[model samples]
Target: MSESNTPEQNSQPASATPPKQESLLANLLINIAIPALILAKLSGDDWLGTKWAIVVALAFPLLYGLRDFLQNGKANFFSGLGVVSILLTGGISLMELDAKYIAMKEAAIPALLGIATVVSLRTRWPLVKTFLYNDKVLDTDKIAAKLEDNNNLGAFELTLKQASWMVAASFFLSSVLNYVLAKVILTSPPGSEAFNAELGKMTALSYPVIVVPSMIVLILAMVFLFRRIGKLTGLKLEDIMAAHHR
Candidate 1:
């Protein structure tokens, strides 16, 4: 007769490792960055103009800096600066009760982000790429090695260019759209009830209009560019993701 196996041993699968926790940076970008941006922009309106809103909006960067500090015992200096800048700007705007200052806050953030992104692209560091993709997997070194071995220098450069352009475009477009909406709201003639109603609708939709389309466009652009880069360099997405994880 054949030997019988125990239930515990027989039921176990060959590979049984648990999933890894998400990296801190990934959590920050997804859960903190986008929502903070939305809150900072929306908090500009007079009706929603509470001091607490400004505090909450500014807390995202602070929390990110705190996480960095806890993880490495050294916070990103610029990240800390960004938190301070947001708080100072919000405080001054609140004290003055100037709606324009609040409106301009949205414009300022995107510009700062664009500048930072451009600076990062100029370096070999690939800071934003590291922040977004690093620690997502466990094979980052292999991916980097593949990128180097594939020798598609042109494709790599194109990826950087596309990313820089997208960052700048998102900033400028969001700022322009927000400015236009603010102008319409501030300039609507008194007693034009129909215009006021339409303005309300536009204002309500403005955040979604700017954010959703920009994000979709950014995603599509990255997908197309990454695919082209993969074909040119003979590197797969899995390879890149793995490389970054290391």
Candidate 2:
């Protein structure tokens, strides 16, 4: 008879390894730089022209997002919303809608996010937990244990709510800036080469004008939450932060 296999040999792995994270530099180049360049430089009669340029420029982000979802094998809320936002942008530009509609759309996305962040507080999972206190960034289990031992859970909850508010505020600020920037940079009528180039300029400027300030606010909120966690749990920042983060 054939020899029986050992249990170890028979056992399958519990799960597949997680997908590798994408490079930040590559993400920026594909999502921002490439699209900006295409729209600004190629939206002319000799090249792709205005309408075709919008299609080609938007295609990069659409495909990149799809690739990211396929690699991760899961869809998060923000990623879904991003896909929708890109679709709306392409639709508006292709239809040759007024620039004001584009400005409104720009403001609406962040405004909706801000409202959602605030509303999530009423549910079991607060947005702050996702953004600031998740296992990716913090030793959440250890922090929970410490809070339990010190009977500081109540205080921790309150502090977390405050952080959530700060995050919402940042989203609101982004909404305002997005509208202003779109309105300021996008003046030419849609379907024109001038309009396409202006859209490209707006896309390129968005990082420094809106994204940088929003990131600063988010960083401040994270710092505040971490400090409060330190105080409540009597743990040092390095101790509470995840090993990878540390």
Q: Give the number of the best model, judged by TM-score.
A: 2
Off by over 4 Å in 2: 1-22
As for candidate 1, its clashing pairs are 139-242, 140-242, 140-243, 140-244, 140-246, 143-243
Clashing pairs in 2: none
Q: Lowest summed-lDDT stretch of 10 residues in model 1? A: 12-21
Model 1 per-residue lDDT tens digits across residues 1-246: 012245533443222222123454454453345444544454444533344454555455567567767877776765666566556555753464444654576466667766777778778765446433244432445545556788766666766667666756766777777666555553433223332333334434654766676677567656765575567556676654432221
Candidate 2 residues 81-142, lDDT tens each? 88888899999999999999999999999999999889999999888888888987788989
Candidate 1 RMSD to the real structure: 10.0
RMSD in angstroms between candidate 2 and the native structure over all alpha carbons: 6.6
Cand. 1 TM to true fold: 0.55
My TM-score estimates for the predictions, one after another, are 0.55, 0.90
**lDDT of each structure?**
0.54, 0.87
